[model samples]
Target: MTMELGLLKALLNKDFYEKNRGLRCPPEIFSKDVRKIKDCLDLAMEKYKADLTTEDLQAVFHATNKTMTTATKVSYDDLFRKMQSTKAIHGEIAEDALSSLFQQYVGEQVAQMGFSFVNGEEESLEPLRRLLDDYKNDFTPSIRVDWDDISIETLMAANKQESQWKFNIPSLRKKIEGVSGGHLIMVGARPNTGKTSFHASLIAGPDGFAHQGAKCIVLCNEESYERVGARYLSAATNMTMDEVHSNVSLAAERYDTVKQNVRIKDSTNKNLSWVEAVVKHEKPDIVILDMGDKFSSKTSDKTDVYLKDASIYARNIAKQYKCAVIWMSQLSAAAEGKVFLDQSMMEGSKTGKAAESDLMVLISKNPQVEGADEQDTQRHLNIAKNKLKGGWHGVLHCDLDGDRSLYTS
Candidate 1:
């Protein structure tokens, strides 16, 4: 093979691994030494600073060599030579391998059914069509659907786990189970309707997922890290921002506890792909996007199309990571002064409203009037859409403390 197992091992040993972070290592190349080499590489990287010293490389080589009985010990010189050569021809080798595989497939197909046919005829084009389908299937990676028998005991155990993941809101939690794994919960509200505060409550409130020991990550695009942190501290400590700022030591102590379970990222200018990457790395139980409209789209499509695609991406990320994703969005101008808000009131795209979310919530301040009292505002949580139990919708009322940036049931 042009890309050998030894080459991959050598590349991952030290300096090469950092330089070739984007390199694709084929699993087939390391049939025997894959685990050993990976472990050694991980250890080497963890122990070393930047480049692996001579002693570090030797230690890894000896560890891997000791695990093998039949395989010959690889000399450092030989390994370095192989790595250098592989680096030069890696791209060419991959291209050539794919081309050869395609050619071989065509040859086999032609041999099985003789290629003595007219051009563009159904019989002549059948093999090509099959080839294209096979290629597409091979290249497109997807989550595997396992067809296996499940015991009642297994089902009950899974149910117990699912039951633990619930929304922080009391009425919503009672009406609907918490935001379970692979679910997208969309929160929409009119401007200045305390959408950000509601989400913060879900992360730092006493009944929140984070407070329940679930690892949480919040991506804030519109707000600064300092502002988000202050809000979280205010919510967690039951103190206003002004109080938290004045009592720095007490706020810091409370924040230290909050930081143990939750992570906040400044996601300014970050796209859905960046969010996916963060999810993959952190593997948090819950992910909160402060504002869905801030997420950059993958395509140069229109706003609606971009929103649709972005929502799908968020949903897929939730499923792939087995986490709950709470995405915040804004309501259109038409929703202003309206007592009740539905999916149609969602700004920008209906696809986000119609398809992406597993649960949709609309927030509106009580009275729905201009110049509402910031301190006395009673925020109403409207369950506009709930996929968990069809035909189940209700409204939950909470007191919004503007000073602490908290919403309480």
Candidate 2:
């Protein structure tokens, strides 16, 4: 039989200690107001003449209402007696219990002070994962992985199967091929620049190698479902350019290869929250945010706040899901010629987006001489910064065909 009086004393003592100290007593019981748990165990051992096992300490540590939810068969005194039997293991157990208890009691206060988690410790977890669990459960936040996390082995694997393929392999321009995970690709051009056509070619033909065997989600903020559908139809049908717009329904059958696979949406979601939800649900291999300006928050007018939120929103979703996001951003007037720092072509809030982006590509119409013919208006894709390669730069080609948004090298 257990002494209910001893258990009562322990409970009463706990109350008294917390009252005076303005804090709950940790399991270690070493706080200024309370004696260490080891001392309590010693006193209980002398009083009960019973030896406790290591398992007994573990059981007691978990059993205490102070730390755990469930009650145990052993009285509070039995916990003391058992802990005294194995000082070393009990001490270690007490330490863990104490740390956990301390955290539970003080975590809220600590968070108010703006303390973050220690990396490589138990704190690493995703933010959304924490909200759903109970303290009967716990969660941690995971850090975002940068380009450095890509091991040489993974790079080698991404390259090994390619180099030797046949059938023209339907290669895209070097610019598109160079994009990888965790990048923010801004492909912009004057009206009719083949942005849509290029993207369709990627999704339907071999040029879309970046998306091959990869699950992709395209968010078409500017176009409706029917308009975008027709483009996709053209890419799959091998139909002449004129025939595609005329008979789009004919190409619907070929989508069987990608019908169930390729996820496309042609709706206007200005805030981009809808995109976030889709990313969470589908876990697509690549996500394309058609345009950047439409996603800005209403409360913000400054580019910093706007892009900052956009970056936070996009990066968080991308990192959490471990997928690539191809975000299209518009450039400003001066930005049309050269890639400027912080403010070049991005209409507003570029600093935040540029800072958070793993990579930035600048697209502009190739400079034309005064008398050049209309056909001479070529486009240029400049590698503004390839953060993964430590800020390297390169160039590619872009061309916008009339009415059809077919982007080509």
Each prediction's whole-model lDDT (CA): 0.71, 0.52
Candidate 1 lDDT by residue in tens digits, 1-409:
3354434534544455553332122232243544344445556676664655434555676765675444345544455455445542334343344344445554565555554454423455676667567555343322335785589998777666654566676766778867677888899999888887887787787667777888889999987978887778788877887787789899877766667888888999999999999999999998989887788574755777778888888999998999988899989998887767788888988665458888888998755446755444778888888876434787878778866777777
Q: How many clashes show up per model?
A: 2, 16
lDDT of 2 at 275: 75
Candidate 2 lDDT:
0.52
Model number with the top TM-score: 1
Scanning candidate 2 in windows of ten residues, the lowest lDDT window is: 162-171
Error of 1 at 119 (Å): 8.8
| Residue-pair clash count for candidate 2 | 16
- The candidate maximizing lDDT is 1
Can you give the lDDT of residue 205 in candidate 2?
A: 51
TM-score, cand. 2: 0.60
Instruction: Estimate the TM-score for candidate 1.
Output: 0.65
